[model samples]
Target: MALPPRPTPNLGWSLEEPRNEGNSLSVVERRMLERGKKEHSETTLATTRALQIAEQCQEMASSTLIEVQRQGHALDKVEHGLDAVEQDVKEAGRLIKFMRRWCCFQILCCCDCFDPDASMDKSRQRRVRMRAQEEAAMAEGQREFHLAQQAAVLRMANKGTDSAYNGNDAKARSELFAANIRRKTSSREGEALPGLGYGLPDDDQHELQRETQLQDANIDRIGTTVENLRLMSLDLQGELESQAPQVDRLGDRTHVVHDNLTVLAKSARRV
Candidate 1:
């Protein structure tokens, strides 16, 4: 079956790539564009994963509510299941964030490639920056949810609410507890859930935090890289401008010199 067309992003950009100058995109611009398209799709896929996870959470909540209404039987299982749901949610959130940053980066590249207007590009860049901020906010929110889930999981484990959901390998145990819920939801889920931050200890929860810091450091390097690349692009343009005259002179000299050398060799042979 034919698929529906994807809607254009509301980037206020309808300007086609400058193909009239050459082909669809210059080499550098083409790379940037491909990165943008690639990252955008990944972002969309990550977002879909997140949504599916959210729905999983909702279903878990609903089932727990139903169980509560019944007789509070197996409440421990429901709590363990909720912790598992929380873990899955955190995993989805991390992917959403990781993809968002790359998505923002690629959007900037796309804006630069397709738009000659500096003002427009700057506006778009600013928007992407804000999007990055939103991603950061989301990371913070996920941290809170994880902390809550961690506390609940710990409380339940200490009370021996669910021995099957605890141990030195709490992550694996919790995952085992959550597995049934995942199976129930999988048929209704859109795509594969993102796999990240699995089996992290409470002390090791800082892994994603450290990664975020490193990414921030990398963002600082982007400014330096862009300045250098801009200078190189300008240098290339200048070199191309002067190259025409130098190439003409050199080509004329080499051709005449080669012919003269050939003639001189012939004369030498005759002599």
Candidate 2:
């Protein structure tokens, strides 16, 4: 075989096949490969760890936001509820206050209706009225007695007195004049003037005049009673009217107080 190509130097010759230059690794190359492999592994591990940490952080943040939102919503609900409650409370208070005012006004009205001062006036008036009545009765009796005296005097004058006696007539006339003067005085003092104008013996008519004076006195007393009663009743009515509005105002104030209290309560609840 023509020397078999002079024995190809057996470059691949050792029995285990010479380590190929291409296949054999140098120490530096091996070290470089190992370093590269180690770096790659570290980079992958770092990437994975970083991704996991980022995911964990995102989850924590999301949970935190959810909690915050939930709390905010709860707070909003509470605030809204409080506002409504406050309004209700305020309204209730206002109503109660109004009711209180009404009650006070009613009480004041009652007081005005039955004022004790008015009662006092009434009691005094009653006593005065009684006195007036008694005086009127006394005057009436006096008048009746005087009328009887006058009739008797007239009849006696007609039967017993001797005419033709100027002196006797004059004495009788003087006496009659004195009696007439007394009658006039009684009439001026509001006594009932007897029917003095009726034609009758002057001597007999004095008693009649006196009776008329008594009637006049009774009339005067009745007039006074009427006037006084009228004035007193009018004054009582005026006073009652004047005080009535005060009672109503007090009731209104009480109602206002209740309304204010209700509003304050509601405000507090809202807070």
Candidate 3:
């Protein structure tokens, strides 16, 4: 009562034989051929993956280059705008300084020409002018009186041929008129000329002379101050002009350094 057939041992087949190898190679050759084919497939896949990664790196670098170029152009435009703004500001400063200097010059002219208390000074000058006119009129009156006396003498001489009494009356009349003229002149001479104001300005002539001299001095001082301001403003303009190129160069160097750093970063990524 035993089993009819026991299981057969696979003794004829070589160890580790892959399926469908019997038609092409011996046992050892089939094993080596399978390993070689697998290695070739793995190498091909690795090469394809490497090619794709290289293409990706190239695209990234190209895009980065375009972006860096665009940024560089933008930076240059920004620097140009800044330069233009600085120039505008400098010009405006120069114009303001010029206007201020012109105003200062005008003020100096005003100080030289106009008095602060013009009304009071004008009143004093008017009084002085009136006094001068009065004196001139009085002198003219004296001359007229002298002429009248001479005319009276001539009349008396002409009338002497007619009567001595008439000549005497004419002489008396001439003497009386001369006496009246002398009395009026003496009275006016004794009276003091009235003056106005507090102290120095009481004499309008002296005050006018002093004010003219003071005005001249003040004008000179103000002109000197305006000249100094102009010089300082010009100096600042020259400094700004001289430094403008250096500032632009510094900005360019900054962009150049950024570009160099970007190139180095790209190279590192490739490594």
Candidate 4:
């Protein structure tokens, strides 16, 4: 006899249930994958922007360095001009000294006279002493002026050195900033997905870094050369100030010597 007919399997319900479940699972997975892709794209864009910013900073730094160098050159020219002024001053001093000595010598020789009386002898000796004293005073004034000039020079030199050190520090900081940017870019590229071409090749990157380091070294050597020039100008100004007193003293001494010599001449003529 035929077995009782098996209840018709609920194949439709079973197949429909499984299909619905699979579709739901697939939709969730697709959404998750899309979200991941979007995040990755955003990350890549951000990295690119960062690279651009880094490059801009590098350009700015380069321009700053150039400006600093230009300033340094200008300072050098100023220093040269000051040097010329100093030479002129020195020449003037020599000429003045020569003229004074020559005039004094002539006056002394003209006033010289042989005197047999004791009073005349004493007067002649006094004239000689006064001449010696005048010469010594002139020499002392010259020495004082020289010393003042030297001191001023030393102070200016120190100031220039300090300014140079400050410039070097600024240059070093810029170089370091650039180096850090390069390092970060390299690391970011390494972390990025393959084939994204997010950063420079290893060789190019290394070359860039090397070039940056070289620039850094060059900048360090640059120091604030202009600072030295400024210092030189200050030194010259101080030198002039110091000379003023010496000049006044020399003038007063010359006047006193002239008066004494005039009196001696009258005495010799009378005798």
In model 4, the runs with Cα more than 4 Å from the true position are 1-28, 99-271
Instruction: Name the lDDT of candidate 1.
Output: 0.44
- Tell me the whole-model lDDT of each prediction, alpha carbons only: 0.44, 0.46, 0.45, 0.45
Tens digits of per-residue lDDT, candidate 1, 96-209, equal 444444456565755545434434334554655675576566656655644444443434322322323323355345444444444444443433223432343333234443
Model 1 superposed RMSD (Cα):
42.8
Give the per-residue lDDT digits (tens) of candidate 2, residues 41-61.
Answer: 465555555545544444453
* Cα TM-score of candidate 3: 0.29
lDDT of 2 at 268: 47
For all predicted structures, in order, the TM-scores are: 0.21, 0.30, 0.29, 0.32
lDDT per residue as tens, model 3, 1-271? 8978978798986565555532544556557655754564465555555545544444453344334333443444555545444444444444444444455665575553454443433355565567557656665665564444344333332221222212346534544554454456545543443441123223433443444444343333333333323323343354356556756886785676566556555544543
On the 0 to 100 scale, the lDDT of residue 11 in model 2 is: 72
Q: Write the per-residue lDDT of candidate 4 for residues 1-271, one digit (tens) a residue.
A: 8889789777655433232243433445546545754565565555555545544444454344334433433443444434344444444444444444455655565343432242433355465567557656665665564444444334333332332322246534543554464555545543424443225345434544444444433333223223334334443344456546655655565565556556555544543
- Which pairs clash in the backbone of model 3? none
Q: After superposition, how far is residue 90 of candidate 4 from its true place, in Å?
A: 0.9
Q: Rank the candidates by lDDT, best first.
A: 2, 3, 4, 1
Best by TM-score: 4
